[model samples]
Target: MALFGLFRRKPHERLGFELYGAAVRAARQPVFFTELAVPDTLDGRFDLIGLQVALLIRRLHRDPDPRGPGIAQAVFDAMFADMDFNLREMGVGDMSIARRVKNMWEAFHGRAQAYEAPLQSGDGAALAEALARNVWRGALPADAAQPRRLAALALATDTSLAAQPLDALLRGEARFPALEEAPHDRDAGA
Candidate 1:
């Protein structure tokens, strides 16, 4: 029992996990599926969750606090841990789990980087193209409207996350906005 206690997570790690959970819930919101037409498949869910987490990581890396980077890392660890668990739950062979997860990590990293510049520069078209290429997973569409909407949502989501205080984020509380009305003020309640 004491040995198990010795392995317990620190308070901050717990907060990291709580924050990750919030991201997961926000990603699962129905607007992405029903309105934005994000496929509700397993891969789609994974991408949405990954995108949400990436946004948080972006904000955390920019955070002034010394603990920000560590919290971002903890959230990342929790995300991959959930992925591994989900793969096992689906009965992926033990021998293949590591390889599959590595592939997922690579994919996620690539997508995250693809999003970084567009997000930083606030280039909606570039972000839309990236989202279309990744989310649609096929040839570029003739009409870019589909992914354009998603890009708008992503930008709005980022704005909402940015409005929240670092202290609120450190405490594992986040308030993602509604699909239509976003951009609330900083003092808004979670």
Candidate 2:
């Protein structure tokens, strides 16, 4: 007959907390402090929340020591190459795809920098939260009903450094003038 006992939701709350704890546990990894830390190279231009998430993912997934120098650049080159091929299969030409991909990478870099600037100027946790918000926004799947694909994205995204598929990552927000498709040529009556 205890009122306290009747009101107790502690068990349910605890279970919920533990579930989240396990998820974070699954994401955990060790990496160099400097490597995991947001690079000074950002120089303050991108979204803070997104950059923090990027750093968090980088810390969890990237190796502190790579086989060669410029490992980041090499990784980016391979990612863009894959993106280029995908674009080509979708009917974009090699030159157009290359240009668009390069522009998108630059935009990503710039966005990182924008977020970093405010962080260095004294916004810390606020900046991290903002970046987290942006990350969540970016994480929304174009099609939400694909649960299997969504779960894979949740897992893959937590450790991924690859830019999103070009269609999402590029096609404007991160670039100038925007990409316009060329009109198809019509043949004279057969």
Candidate 3:
């Protein structure tokens, strides 16, 4: 059994790390921090990473290909492993690491659930509401413009993900819409 395990290659391990790297890149977009008013704190960064990861997972779940699920699981494993390493780097004690990781997992799952409905519905209002509640954490900006812009960006991201080929996603070649290209609501005249 041990020999078999050693001989078996984890099919998506490398691709999973690549995908996680992509997610991290998406999370670190400068526009999100400067234009969108996303706080630069740890919580804000985590939320952005969680959002990107959730979107990728959602795309995987909706893919008809049989390999989608396996790739998705590998992506998830990569994400949590990165998170664990990050926590340790931040000086979290060994005894507290497991509990902190569990809490982060719960948070990620909750955010995924919150994002799923709006993303599936393709409704701007619903997407805005979900982002406000979760991303902004009920502390929406004094003006509604930032939230509106973020909602538009989120929709663009959803569309971009939907358009990616399943094979590309599985190969860790997924791409997100650039922030500058996120469409604004014409009706709002902004």
Candidate 2 — what's its lDDT? Answer: 0.34
Q: Write out the backbone clash pairs for model 3.
A: none
For candidate 3, lDDT tens digit of each residue in 124-170?
67667767777778898423767677777777887788899987876
The root-mean-square deviation over C-alpha atoms between each candidate and the true structure, in angstroms, is 5.1, 23.6, 2.4
- Poorest stretch of ten by lDDT in candidate 2: 181-190
Q: Point to the candidate with the largest TM-score.
A: 3
Number of backbone collisions per candidate: 0, 13, 0
CA-RMSD of model 1 = 5.1
Off by over 4 Å in 1: 1-11, 139-143, 182-190
lDDT of 1: 0.80
lDDT of 2 by residue, 1-190 (tens): 6977988753224322332233223223222112222222222212222232333323223344442123333333443454466578879876688787777567556555544543334333333333333433334332232222222223233323233332222121111110011111111000
Which residue pairs come into collision in candidate 1?
none
User: What value of lDDT does candidate 3 attain over all alpha carbons?
Assistant: 0.81
* Model 3 misplacement above 4 A: 3-9, 141-143, 186-190
